[model samples]
Target: MSTIAAISTPAGVGGIAVIRLSGSEAKTIAERFVRPLSDHKATYTPFVADGDTVDETMVTYYQAPHSYTGDDTVEIACHGSLYIQQAILQHLIAAGARLAEAGEFTRRAFLNGRLNLSQAEAVADLINSTTEASNQLALSQLRGGYQQKLKEMRQELLDLTALLELELDFSQEDVEFADRNRLLSLSENIENEAMRLVESFRTGNAVKNGIRVAIVGKPNVGKSSLLNALLDDDRAIVSNIPGTTRDTIEDTVTIDGLLIRFIDTAGIRHTDNPIEQAGIDRSMKAAKEADVVVYVVDATDKENLNNPNVPKIQGTTILAINKCDLIDHINTSTPNHIYISAKTGTGLDELKHAIVAPFKEVGDGAMLSNLRHFEAMKCLLAAIRQVRQGLEQGTPSDLVAIDLRDAIHHIGTITGEVTTDEILGTIFSRFCVGK
Candidate 1:
């Protein structure tokens, strides 16, 4: 492969910037501008190109089969000047190093067997992770936690498939190489594992890309106040007038390491006005899609708490009685209500806890965050169930082998054991340039 080079660091001026190169001609291209590069050692050197001194930089070299891309690689660390960085990149390109496509380094790593597809994707996740939970989850996947689990399950299935195939070969000999009882038990366990991973996608997606919390309540019930109080900023306009929040006001804040995206929607109330009705329509949709629904009710008005619209909202509803400071004594018919004064920042901590508590079920185990992985696991589980059904019903060994192989193939797609050009392009296209 031809040499590829790109700026690996984020854009803008910083203390330093990194420009990386990989492929067969990586070292040769680096030699054009960077000198005295020792293998596996950082060598501070002057960068010269086109008979002009550019900048003083540090160069590190890695030899083939041991580097990030399993090829000869070079990384140049230079002062974070836009002029200097661009100049070095142009020099490398002028010397025959092509600009790298997005995620090419990690793609090369995957192609060279250094990392599987799941782990390769985790490289992007680790880079884009915004929270501790997301960081740990991505790191776990990068370390092959998920990959190892899938591989173990695939191997067991593969062994059983081999037995099934052997029995197919000795049909006239009446051989029973694959045990029916053992296959049933094994398939059941594999299906259970796959389903567990599928179920984890909810928490995984919420953690990786902030939990969606929709604030729904009647007009003037502190939906916008709760949003501002939670974010500690005047993100949304607060007014005693009904329909103040004509549209869904959205903002995100990290509470206890979990990202909570607060969507303060217009209060739920019947209105003849088209605009307010549109906002209310959007409010209901947001509530339906949200992971947590914060139903703000006015503590001063008991009738508003019993608003028929409140019961229409779905999902994990946190009944927050706003303006509790005004009420001398709080009385609630429901046991699952949290009394809070959004105007005074009272009971906000408990509300935040209630929002993040649902996501606390995510343990140390690797989760299925990617939709592609989840779909593949769903297919895998379905195929495993079919195989289990065939074995239990005493279906022909050859037919059962087909389903078994299908299950293995779906599992392979998750790890890139079975992949195509389209899959690679789609997965890597989402990565930032020069990954």
Candidate 2:
């Protein structure tokens, strides 16, 4: 492979920036800028291009088989000036090193066996993690969380297959070397583990992508005020006039490390104006699409929770009693009513608790956040089920081997023993250049 180089650090002016290079020629190219580049050592020297010193930079070099890509690698930490960063990169490209593709270094790592496919994918997740929950989830997967278990499952399947396939070689003599009861026990364990991962996808998805909560109600129900109170940012426009908010206003807040995106949508009511009707339509759609809908109501209004008009909602609905500070006695005919003043910050904590109630039990176990892994889990489960059924019915060893091989193939996909270039390209393309 050709030598590849790119800016490894985020673009912009920081205290310092990093430019990375990896390949067989990485050390040779780096020597052009700063000679005597000792392996696993950092040298503070002048970086040069075309006999002109560009900047005083710190350079580190790693020998082959020890670097990230399993090739000789060099990293230059230079001043954070954008001009200097570009100058160094352009100079490197001019010196026979080509620009690196998105995630090329990590892709090379995966290719070199430095990391499995799932662990390589986790690098991107770890980099893009915004919340603590996402960070922990990514870190867990990066540390051989689910893939390790898959590897164990694959070993068991391999042992079972080897035993059965060995029987095929001795076909001349009618003999059964494999134990059916043991095969049954091994396949049963694989089935249970596969199902557990499939079930964890729901929780993993919620932690990976924040939950959506739509704060919706009739006009002038303080939905915007409640939104501002929840975020404490006054993000939405509050007005006494109905239909002041003609679009959905959204913001995110972390409750127990789980992201909850609260969308303050337009009031749901009849209107003559087309614009207001459009907003109401969006509000209805948001309610249906949201995971939870907080139905806001005025505490002082004559029509209280006794007969509140809640639009048809598919998600969980919670009754929010806003402007409770204005009324001394809070009367609610429904048991699901939560009295609170968005203006006075009353009962907002309870509202937040209610919002994340369903997701409160998100465990810190290995879970499936990737859709590819989830689908693979399903396939593995199906294949293993067939294997167990075939064994129970006294199917031929060769026939049983087919399903067993298929099950092993599915498990291999998660760790990348069975993969294609297209799949690798698609997975690595999501990463930033230089990894």
Candidate 3:
């Protein structure tokens, strides 16, 4: 195969950037740009271009079938000058290496069977990870945790399929190779496993992305201030007057390894002002859609909290009594209340802990965070349900077998065992160029 080369590290100025080369001729291509740093090198010698040996650098080599793409691979770490990086890449291209396409390295890994489709996708996730939770999840997937689980489930289905097929082959002999009770149990087990993975996607997806947390309250209740405090920046404008914020301002914060997207919405109130009323409508909409609602109340305005006129709260609303520093004395009668001075960053840590508490019950380790995987699991569960119903109704083995096969197909979709070109294209296209 032809050698492929790309700038593996991110673009722009940095301490260093990596240029990666892989394929049958990767070593040969690298040899052109790198000059050995030592005569009898204990470690692999650093290389520099023959004509332009400005600075010595390190070089490591991996032979074919053992490298990232299952091809000979070489990574060059050099000073991150755009011109210098481009020069090295250009020299490699001139020396018979072609530029790799977006995600080509990972795509090659998949094509070479070194990694499955799911694992290859995890490569992108790892690179794009912006939060600790996402990074851990991606690492788990990259290490084959998710793939191994899927493989076990698929093997279970395949075993049952094989037994069913064998029984059909011996139909003329009237043999009962697959016991009825064992078959039902196997189906149940597979269904339960799939259901568990399907259920985890809810929390996993939220954690992989940011959990949407919306700040809701009447105007001038320091919702914007709380947002700025949580984000550690003035992401939203603050004002002493009410109805100052006319739209939702979103900012992401990474707390306790979880990404939380804080959306500070316009204050909720019944206002005759057309612009203010429109903002209030949007606030209500954001409140309904958010995963968690931070219901901010002015500490001085105790009557508003007890007022029946306040709009009905929804979701897991945490009442944040803002402006606590201003109040001479604060009471603790309100349910699920936290006192905070967003201006002074008081009780913010406690609020962050409370926000992440609900998700802690979700087990540590790998989870099915991909939406496609979630959908496939859901389909598998439906098919399994059909099979279960068939068993309960004493349906013929043939009918149950059909449902089982359908379930297998849905499971296969997650690992690309039953995927299409369009699906593959859609998935890999999301990757940045030169991955």
Candidate 4:
């Protein structure tokens, strides 16, 4: 295959940028730009490239069958000036290296059978991770944790399939090389694991993205003030009048190493104004869908808390009593209530801790972060259900085998053992160029 070249580092100026070349001609093409640093002219050497030298760059070479793509690979570290990076890349292209498409290097790794689809996807996840939890999940996947689990499941299915196929060969002899009870138990175990993986997708996906925490209450209760305090930025407009915020404003804040999406929703209240009513409706919707609901109540107004018009709180609801500094007579015994003065930043730390605690419990470990993996797990679960029903009825081993194999195929889809080009394109195309 021809060599492919790209600027592997992020665009714009930085301390340094990396230009990568991989494939059969990688070493040959790299030699055109970079001269060997060693006196002995070793195949692998630290060197500086020719042309407009941005810096005394380091060049490392990896030989075929031992590199990232299972082929020759070269990496050049150059000064991060855009002009120099572009000049080096253009030089490699002129020296007979084709420009790599988005995720082409990773695609080459997949094509060369170096890594499976799940591991390849994890590469992107690791790069985009914004939280410690997300980084750990991605790193685990990249190290083949998910792939190993899928392989074990597939091996069990393969064993059952082989036994079933052998049984068909001796139909007249009435031979049973495989134990029926053992096969049933294996199917049950696979089904249970598949279901667990399917269920984990929800928590995993929420962790990868930030957990949505919506601040909802009646207007002029300092919802905007609360948002600004949490973010440590005055992003929303604060006002004394009701319905000052006519739309939802979202900001992300990292709390306890987890990213929490703080949404300042328009206050929920009955209104004759159409725009205000629409905002109220949106607030109610966001409240219902949020991972945690911060029910903001004005500490100065005891009447607001008793108001029957307040929307029903759901999920993990935390009652945030705003303007605590101004209220002398405030209830301290309320369950899950946090007293905070958003204007004064009182008890803000406690509020942040409360917001992060729920997510930590939801996804502790073994979370499946990819949606495609989740969908495949769901499909595998359905197939396992069929196998369970077949076992309960004492159905023929042949029919049970079919369901087992179907479940296996669904599981295989997660790791690209059984997948189509359309799915591959959709998965890899989302990656940034030069990855």
Q: List the residue pairs that clash in candidate 1.
A: none
Question: Which ten contiguous residues of candidate 3 have the minimum total lDDT?
Answer: 36-45
lDDT for model 3 comes to: 0.79
Question: How well is each residue in 88-111 modelled by candidate 4, as lDDT tens digits?
Answer: 888889889999999888888888
Error of 1 at 56 (Å): 0.8
Clashes per model (N, Cα, C within 3 A): 0, 0, 3, 0
lDDT of 2 at 310: 78
Query: Per-residue lDDT for 1-435 in model 3, tens only?
Result: 788999988889778777888998888787766653222232243445666563344566777787788888887777788877887888888889999988888888888889888877788788878888788888888777566666777777778767877888787787776666776786788788787888687677877888889998988999998998898897888999989899989988778888999999998877799988888888988888787888888888879755513345444778888889988877756677888889788899999988888765435445788877888889989998998788889876677788888988887888767768776776788687667
Model 2 CA lDDT for position 158: 91
Q: Pick the candidate with the highest TM-score.
A: 1
State which candidate, 1 or 3, has the greater TM-score.
Answer: 1
Minimal lDDT window, size 10, model 2 = 357-366
TM-score of each: 0.94, 0.86, 0.86, 0.88
**Global lDDT scores for all candidate models:** 0.87, 0.88, 0.79, 0.81
What is the lDDT, from 0 to 100, of the residue 125 in candidate 1?
Answer: 88
lDDT tens string, model 2, 314-406? 557999988999999766777787988998899999998998887665454478888888998899999999998988898888998999999
Model 4's C-alpha root-mean-square deviation from the true structure amounts to 3.3
Q: Can you tell me which runs of candidate 3 are displaced by over 4 Å?
A: 32-57, 169-175, 307-315, 325-334, 343-345, 360-364, 416-419
Error of 4 at 210 (Å): 1.5
